[model samples]
Target: MPSKTSIFLTGATGAVLTRLLNHPSSNTFDITVLVRNADKANILRTKFGIKTVVGTHQELDKVESLAEGAHVVINLAEADNVPFMKAILSGLRKRQAKLGDPPLLIHTSGTGLLADDARGEYITDVIYDDLNVEQYKSIPDTAVHRNVDLLVINADIEGYARTYIIPPSTIYGIAKHALVDAGVSNPHSIQIPVIIEASLARKHAGVVGKGKSFWPDVHIDDIADLYVVLYDTIVANPENVGHGWEGLFFGENGEHSWYQISKAIGEAMVTLGICTGPEPTPFTKEETEKYFGSEQWGWYSSILPREPGACLGMEADVHH
Candidate 1:
């Protein structure tokens, strides 16, 4: 029998990765996940029947060793961790040297790299095109995730690895997977929940500034299927899909302004008796930091890409 393609995956406990593992195409590939907690690793091993490596992404040597054994490396962990990416690229380079074939690296980035400093005051007219190689190259290295994106692109340019980046914006919906059922995976996404919790706590939907900042959105399953489609495309024929600069696939179906979402949340809160007001309220900078965490308030207050290219033809089945 022919051997299954080996895939080394990080962020096994995350929502997107968990849903990707649950996809039916996952059975065709040999997937080994890197997990930090020993008990979660055990559950993923015995329950899901996939290989497990007990280590964090911070462990450079361990990460390098694992990447050396895989035909593909999917990094769903920290997007901007330079050292972690460097270690993976180093291992993939060694593997390329030994096997005389370049391996594939699929990195998860965010559309926040396309963000502008609107600060929730107004929306920008610029739309990011994934197919525009020159436009993508023009993104400043100082942007949130561009440094790591550049690292992957440079590796692809050096001919050691074929690299693709999926930059998803505001992923929603609960993840359905065996790991989630086995009490191992985190089934929920991040941004919307922060809005909800903060709203419930303060008894009004929280908005940052004028809340005019908008971002694209995608369902959990729809985005997961994009990953599957990319994997299948790569396995079928590497030439069929673009790598490096041309390989950025933005995962988004629709767009929503922060004000629109917050108003809906406020209405829902009033209906559910969680809050008395049906109108959204603005959050102070300090309150935003306190409720949404110091790091995440910027996203709520800033404009992400108004239009992200859906290069692939996958239609999102779920809606807001």
Candidate 2:
């Protein structure tokens, strides 16, 4: 019998990673995860029966060691870390030299790279197409996650690894998996939880400015499935999929304005007796900074106009 494909995974406790582990296809691969917490690593080991390496992304040598041993590397750790990316690529480069063949890398990026500075005041009409290689290559270097993204692209260009990038939009919905059900993994996502927490804090749902700026969104399940689909394709025919700039794939179902999201949150808050009414108010700058933090202000204020182009060929199961 053929041996199981060895895979190295990061961000294993995340919603997407948890869901990916729950997929049936995952059982066919020899999966290993790098976890910072030794206790969480033990839980993942006991629950999923996969190899667990207890180390943080900051440990470049350990990261390189793991990458060198794996047939494929799926990174969801941090999208903006250049040093971490360099470490992973270094290991993969060594693996290619030893095996005389390129390994596969599935990287997780974000739609924020395409976000426009509308500041929740206006909607920008510039939509980025993920399948258009030239368009993706044209994105300015100053974008949020562009530096690390360029590194991955350059690695692919150098022919050491077959790279595929999935840039997801605002992901929503609770994730269901053993780790999540066991309370070891977070079921909620980044953006939605911030909004929910702010609503609870102020006793009312609110939005940044006029909340006219919009962003594309996807259900957690849908985005996770996309990862699995890409993996399966790599397992079957890695050469068929696009790589480098051509590999940019946007994971989004539909777009939603911040006002609409706040309105929904308001209605939910009203039903739960957390707020007085089901109408959202615009938050002031002070409230925005206090509730969501100054760093995350762009998330609530910018317009991320992106549409899935390459992965659209497979037809994403939209749960929006």
Candidate 3:
């Protein structure tokens, strides 16, 4: 019989990771998750039968210790937490030096890194495919998600863990996880929920500018399946591992316009008697901040477009 893979997972409560935890293959591993809340920890332990370590991402020492023993470290938490990432990498590097083999580090990112920042009025024709090495290389260092992803890839090249970045597009749909039996489901996707909340509060639905900007989209289940596929491929064939698969792996199945999404939300609200009209309106920067708060204004209201060519194309094996 094959030895069980030891998996250290963060963000077990997130949308993608929640589905991953419920995947059939998840039972094949010895899983330990780091969660910040006591209630969530109890739920994960009771519902999924996974071990838990109580700590936040800011707790570097705890994160490092948990990562050191695992053969695979899957991080689905905040991509912008550079210090936490450094801690995880530091632990993996130490383990590599001692064991003479690197662990697999799967980090979550998003296709927003490819966003053109059109802020809703403009559209770009450039799309980046994961197989297109040149386009991947051309991603600007200043891109929203570039720094941490580059950090992980560079660590892989330095003989730490064999790292792969999964940059999924805006994820939708409810996650199908065992935690749902415990009456817990991962929250709805970020963009749409905020729009819904603001619409209910203000008595209308709104978008940014002309709302023509596009973002790639994928279902929560599909994103979880891709993670499992990548994991199985790597574990089954160690010889397939190298720097070649170190960078971005996108999870987009399709794309949608902000205007169309807003219109749908408006129609839903009207049908439900939450608002008076099915016609959507546009919100200015100040108005957006007033409704969604200043921090979330840009994220919920901007026009972020990914070029059509940037589709992931869903390869079963990462090497291909």
Candidate 4:
């Protein structure tokens, strides 16, 4: 029999979090949305008949208190840098110290921690079932991945919490109604950066380098599903699944080369009346800069091969 678990999600209304809420797994587990607005949280209760707890991003302790003896705490809140995540881990520690059993913690993170994509190191295809945890932790010390992973392990040592990380390659899924500042419109979201790369491909973008570095990616829904799957997988098979661990599911449906991306952008530019179709690839990063803007193209994100599966087979009712 599976244990009835309650999960507290920090970024409850995010593109990925939205998919998790509507997933079938949500039916089995008791979910509590942790957001900054009490009114907004209450809306989820009225709409989905689900419970939402209003809480701040930096202070997860109050949310922890609301969680009380929850089965899981899923955090996707990373404000500023790594401090927010470090704070969540700290909150769990306080919970176990004060309360009896701190919940199992699930963190939404990226694989860049394993290798610095900016440094041109990309490692893919190997499964966590085969690799050693401590070894991958050594890849990029600068990668907040190492710090976050350590926090989970530390919590486990104190018997405060069991931590799991669901690392997304590059996610491009249906952006939620409220998920603004993402996708092709903003170009900062993982979806546009990894899968679409519209700003970079249009010759409107520049490479953070020679424009050849690449990274793996997945669709946001598949990424969201993994969290739900992780919770259920553990609930049904604690005998088999380890609590203190990580799952690296790149969820790449298709691998596209950098050249292909540049070509696609060229075609789009001509179609959108931004540039002539025959215009040479990146004739000048400045020319294309009009569209993506210099600030948006600060990091040359256009060149990487999109990790496959931006759109899983399922119909995306959630708008892009």
Best by lDDT: 1
**Residue 239 of model 3: what lDDT?**
69
Cα lDDT tens digits for candidate 2, 21-131: 666766667888999999888888897787999999899999999999888899976788889999999999999999978888999887777766565677765667776
Q: Model 3, range 111-160, lDDT digits (tens) per residue?
A: 76776656677666675778777777787898766778788888887877
User: Which TM-score value belongs to model 3?
Assistant: 0.87
Model 2 score (lDDT): 0.75
The candidate with the higher lDDT, 2 or 4, is 2
Residue 58 accuracy (lDDT) in model 1:
85
What are the runs in model 2 whose C-alpha is more than 4 Å off? Answer: 14-28, 295-320
TM-score of each: 0.89, 0.88, 0.87, 0.69
lDDT (10s digit) by residue, model 1, range 101-135: 89999998887777666656777677777888888
Which whole-number lDDT from 0 to 100 does residue 180 have in model 4? Answer: 38
Going through the candidates in the order shown, the clash numbers are 0, 0, 4, 10
User: Residue 159 of model 4: what lDDT?
Assistant: 74
Candidate 4 per-residue lDDT over residues 136-168, each given as its tens digit = 444554543556656666677667777766555
Candidate 4 residue pairs in backbone clash: 169-217, 170-217, 170-218, 204-288, 208-300, 252-308, 253-308, 253-309, 254-308, 254-309
Indicate the worst ten consecutive residues by lDDT in candidate 4.
311-320
Global lDDT of each candidate: 0.76, 0.75, 0.71, 0.50
Model 2: weakest 10-residue lDDT segment is 308-317
What's the true lDDT of residue 27 in model 1?
71
